[model samples]
Every structure is written in structure tokens, then in C-alpha cells.
Target: MCDFTVAVFRPDDDRLEDAVELLESLGATPVPDPMLAVEPTGASPRDDADYTILTSKTGAELVAGAYPGTDSDGVADGGARTDRWNPGEATLCAVGPKTADALRERGYDPEIVPQEYTSSGLVAALEDRVDGARVEVARSDHGSPVLLEGLEAAGAYVHETVLYRLVRPEGSGDSTELAAAGGLDVACFTSSLTVTNWLEAADERGVRDAALEGLSNATVGVIGEPTGETAVAAGIDVDLVASEATFETLATETVELAAPTYYE
Candidate 1:
């Protein structure tokens, strides 16, 4: 078994568990240290139309709760008209399978999803169809600009709806976590905010060197290229990137890349 322990900074417990499972299956130990907390956006829902794009699962869940009882699937409640989402007829683009599955479970079938599962990939996939189309993006308040910008540049009338927000976890001592991270081998960053929060936490904990050294020594795995870029900018050497920008793919690649230090 590999002696190295992989550190994960995902906020969700279920996602953390999934990553841990993948690492353990490959004999690599996992240490979860979530830096950011996700919360629902207080924004009210707007009228729906032909195309609705779900960018993240959290956003989907928020919309589902806001629009309760509208769909039989119980995913979306009642904000927008359900009849507008004609499944195979209307086009719905999702950033990842999780978001796509969320839509599916809610009674809306997505027609377009990127193979790479990143904002850029999703934008690229929808560029052709988005031209001159009316598109609504359901996403977090802190979502990336790539999707919205790309769609607008492609002549699509894009309306972005905030569904959630990411903030620093309350009562979590950033400095303490960073100080403790010195013993960790790998630091996994899933989002840009995670990178920012982790740096702040490390600085607060007075373990910047430990965090930096750990990141430099061990592989820094990221879910997408944007996140990888953030790590590189923070002086963390990235070793592996998920082929598809999903937690499952991230875990899979993380285990495979760290397999040299792990046992089956």
C-alpha cells in the first residue's frame, strides 16, 4: 500500500466519501479538509423558457427545492413551467453527469452534456446550438464566467440565475488546518475558491511552508483546467488532471496517478 495520504478539499460530505472510497480502493489514504461551505442563494426564481442549463448539482438541488411539487419526479418544485421542458424536444445542457442526473431525476431530460464535463467543454458543446437561442443558466452566485460569456459571445440570449453561494466555513480555523496539513502528502483542490480558502487557512495557521511543501511534494490533482491553473499560480505543482471534470473522474485519476505509492 502507498504510504502517502491524499488530502481532499471538497465541501460536500457525500463527495468527500466518494473520493475517499476511490483512494482507499487503490490503497492510498485520504484526508478530507473542506475549506469552503456551500449555501443556498436567496435569489428568487424567474420565468423559465426553452433552454435551461444546470451547471452544478448544488444549483440543481436549490432549484428543485424552490420549485417543489411541479414535477412528478420531485426534483423541481414550481418556479418555472414544467411543460416547457419537453425532454427530447427541448435542449438542456449540463456541466456534468451529476447535474444531468439531477435534471433527469426532476423530470427534465438534458439533451446536451460535455464529454469533458467542464465549463469550457460545456460551452464548446453548446456553442453551435446556442446561437440566437434563448438560454437560462441555473448556477451558483460564484459560478465561473466562461459559460455565460461564451454563450453570449456565440449570440445566445443567456440569462443567469443564481442558485447557491460558496463561503468560508464558519468557526473553522484556517490557520490550524494549514498547520496540520504539513503532514499531508497530497492536497486536492476541486474549485478556485478552495484554493483561495486553503491559502488563507494556511496563512492563518502559520503553516504556509507546510502547506506549500506538501502541495509541492505531492501531486496536486484538480477537477478542471481552471482549478489546475489556480494551483499552478499558487506554486503548487499539478501532477494529474481528470479527463472529465467530475468528482468521480477526479477520484479515478487521483487513485491511478498515486497508484505507485498504493496497493490494490
Candidate 2:
């Protein structure tokens, strides 16, 4: 166990209990906080779509959640029903293992999960195939434009639907308390929205500068490269970028960075 406390930005989700257990596994006190609130909207499969793209686990959940009989784990209800469209008939692409797992639980097999867990990675891996294909991307309103732009550049017709909206919750990060308590040991970031929302929350609490200063002193861990880039662009010094853009990897790397002799 290291001498640092691990702070996480986990939005209100069903997996929060698992997250807490994960944080505790690293032998540190966990301060799990929600920087953004996720609200899933009504979104479903399209019959005319040639392929399906899911960028996050939330998007996968939303797609399955829209249909009757499909629960969060994709379990069939007593009289679960699906649309006339067959998800199995369409090519499924997920950004990472967690996202793919979500789809798999819904009985949809993902054919494309990039070696790198990111939009650019997905594009790079499927660039040669997306040309002349019609891709249906289910994502949040805060999703990156990179996927859509890259697919369009590859001459693929894209039909994107917003499956969720991310809103900043009432209270933000406790930078004041953290800074006053000798700063944090690690700060976990899940997405670009998490970073933006944290900054906004801090600013709203009139502690943006103090928050940034505290973060600059702590190790910043990002789920993916784009998120790390977002944090850096926002004047937040970054320390760890997960090799795999998954929560498990993020937690592992955060704990590693917090080792007693990590910076020594």
C-alpha cells in the first residue's frame, strides 16, 4: 500500500460498487466522486444500417436498454422482445474490451475492437474496410467528432444517434479539502467530459486555480490518449495514460504510480 489517496471521477452508475472494490484493492483510501451525470436516451438499432459502432459501455447499454426484455446485462426478460432489425446481422464495432463485453452480454458479437482502445485506433484499424460502408454510431452527446469525421473521410456514410446526455452534477470535486489536506495522490479520469466537467465544477466552486494546482501536484491517470490530451490542454499536468483504455487498467496504473518509491 502506498501513502497516497486515490481520487476517482466515476459518474453515478450501477458499477460503482465494483469501482470501490477495485480502488480498495490497491491499498489506498478511495474518494469516489461523480463529475458528470449520465442520462440514457431512447436509441435503437436501424434496419438500414450496415454496421454498428459503440464507443463506450454506456452506449452499448443504451442500445440494448432501448429494446424490451434486454436488461443491463443483456439478460432476456420474461417476454423480452427485439426490433425487426437483427443486431447479429450487422457488423459490430466496439472501442474497448469493456464496451465489447457490454455488447456481448446483449447477445451481439463485436467483430472489430481495435488494438488501441480509442476512436483513432478504431479508425486506423477499420479504415480499409469502412469505405463505401454505412456505419451507425451510437454515442453520447459529448462523444468525440473524430470517429464521424474519420469515417466520412473514408467515404463511409455515417448515421449517428445520441444515446445519452452528460450533465454536470450539483457538486464538483473537493479541491479545497483535497488541497488543504495535502493534495491527492492520484486523480482518475475516464473521459474528456470528466476532465471538462471537473474543471467546470471547480470553477463553479471558485476553486479552479486551486484545483488545477492540486491536480498538477498529483498523478493524473486517463482512460485513453484523447482524454489525456484533453486534461493537458486544460492546464492539468498528466502523469499516467493507461496502456489500455479500460477502467481496470486505469486503476492498476494509478496504484502503480502511487507506489512508495514510484517517483523516487
- For TM-score, the strongest prediction is 2
| TM-score on alpha carbons, each prediction | 0.83, 0.86
lDDT of 1 at 174: 41
CA-lDDT, candidates in order: 0.69, 0.76
- Which residue pairs clash in candidate 1? 2-261, 2-262, 67-77, 67-78, 68-77, 68-78, 175-204, 175-205
lDDT of 1 by residue, 37-79 (tens): 7665445334554567788766555555533333553333334
Task: Give the Cα error of residue 58 in candidate 1, in Å.
Answer: 1.2
Q: Which stretches of candidate 1 lie over 4 Å from their true place?
A: 66-90, 171-182, 261-264
Which model scores highest in lDDT? 2
Query: What C-alpha lDDT does candidate 1 achieve relative to the native structure?
Result: 0.69
Candidate 2 segments exceeding 4 Å error: 66-88, 261-264
